[model samples]
Target: MEYTLDMAVLAILIAFCVNIVLCPVFIPFLTKIKFGQNIREDGPNSHLKKAGTPTMGGIIIIISFIISSFFFLQDNFEAKLVVFSTLGFGLIGFLDDYIKVVQKRNLGLRAYQKIILQFAVSIAMIYFIVQYGDYEKMHIPFTDKMLDLGGLYIPFLLFIIIGTANAVNLTDGLDGLASGVTALVSTFFIFVSWAVGSGTLPVAGAATGSLLGFLLFNAHPAKVFMGDTGSLALGGFVVSMAIILKLPLFLPIIGLIYVVEVLSVIIQVGYFKATKGKRFFRMAPIHHHFELKGMEETRIVTLFYVITAILCLVGYLGTAGIF
Candidate 1:
């Protein structure tokens, strides 16, 4: 309750430790349950080998976050809200992942189905945020002033919650990309939350620690993939931190990688439709375009990390004065 060291470093360590231990045990169990990933044949040929790697590893991050953040839970209401929202999205993702497992193939929930579920959660997130959120103003980048959105904040908040969740989901195509970038983004959120004296610090800590730990297996030649489950829930967690800090506007700058990932797909598809079957890139998500150009998976992932780190730094510096 006093913002002790355990609430900071120890919580991270605990989360990291938990994931490191649980992953090996969990991966085998998922395999036993036939919960393997199905690679898309139309995608990179190099990714075919990734097929059947145990999927749905998000449970590990969720469990690890809960265990580590539990220490500070009683004192932090906002942190509790984050945990709940994460679990809600996790369930939606789990259902999607489970459908893929049942079909023994890559195809899972239909796009409409997933969007409906996500929108349901987004609406709920907005209701809670509007009811209990601490501030009416958001810090505008490169300005010393905070912008007041008033009731308009509700619709804007809905876009952030739903859009960001799906954006991160699309970014999950590469191993270590989503989790690794999320770790960096969460690290920034943790600091930014502290800067604002937010009650959401514990959830931020959990996010940072669990994703770092998840990278132990989620890295190159990943032993396990977090699937839609981790990406969506993580997206929710990250944006929720912004809501609690009233920094939702800064999220696009901080979460620039997610923006790019989703945009690449939209651009690729929209162009193909307009051109009657031409591509703007060799593949969508941009990472795959790099992959098709012969860039190694690890290299592409690392590059993304660097870019995300730079954008996060920019977002931090820009918002520093207003906060």
Candidate 2:
């Protein structure tokens, strides 16, 4: 256990050092390539000035994880699968970002197109886990019970991979919001992995370190945006990590902020259509509602960070004795 923790820590330091060194040179290069994010016209008015910031920063993040995986998780088959699935999702996000930025269009890949790609990736990942990885049962949180999904696990896994990948995407609105929350969630994954001596520790550590480094420039009054590339990659990696640990059922509890963000958008959209455009929150994503209610972006981000920490604690407690 101690050795695994030490290894996780080493992976984190390596990822952070690599990412920090890459950011300064990377941001300028992105600017030169004109790979700037297109701010949605309908978004918060205060974000107007942030238009054209360098986006697609997920490239560096994925690079860091690739490097981290080779160094710290080379022998772990499950970890490799998680890392590769994340890379696959990163590619999808990269295509989406490319269309939006390079193509100079607000709408990137059409929604169905992205979903189809996501489903393809999800199915591939689920097949790998079921065929290669040993765990086929989910550990019920807060109980000494297991539920075998049998063949149904395929669809269940698909729902989780797609839902969580997009859920984190929706939470990317405010500066540092997605990165900070993801960093915290990744940190929780490290603890959980450590508690069980799981092979997932290295990738989780890599994720934590990369997101923390990204947040240096992504915080309030940001200089760059993560775009879909970062968010979806994050969503992919996070959900994969949870599934790799066989804790997919606990993902919503561990990542409640993401759940709320997605739910808020769904509810807002459904209600708007039902009521013929009568609104609930000032915006779809819940974070935007607080923003419209006069909460500073930094404050909203900070509060979400705190909430994520507490939820992770609950999740950790619930699963502590399972291993």
Listed in order, each prediction's TM-score against the native is 0.96, 0.97
As a TM-score, model 1 comes out at: 0.96
Which lDDT values do the candidates have, in the order given? 0.85, 0.87
Candidate 1 per-residue C-alpha lDDT over 124-241 given as tens digits, one digit per residue, 9 for 90 to 100 = 8777777876666887888888888887877888788888888888899898999999999888877777776676776788788899999989998899999888888888888777
Worst 10 residues of 1 by lDDT: 1-10
- Point out where model 1 deviates above 4 Å: 1-6
Q: In angstroms, how far off is 171's CA in candidate 1?
A: 0.8
TM-score of 2: 0.97
Candidate with the greatest TM-score versus the true structure: 2
Question: Once superposed on the true structure, which residue ranges of model 2 sit more than 4 Å away at CA?
Answer: 1-3
What is residue 146's positional error in candidate 1, in angstroms? Answer: 1.1
Q: Which stretch of 10 consecutive residues in model 2 shows the poorest summed lDDT?
A: 1-10
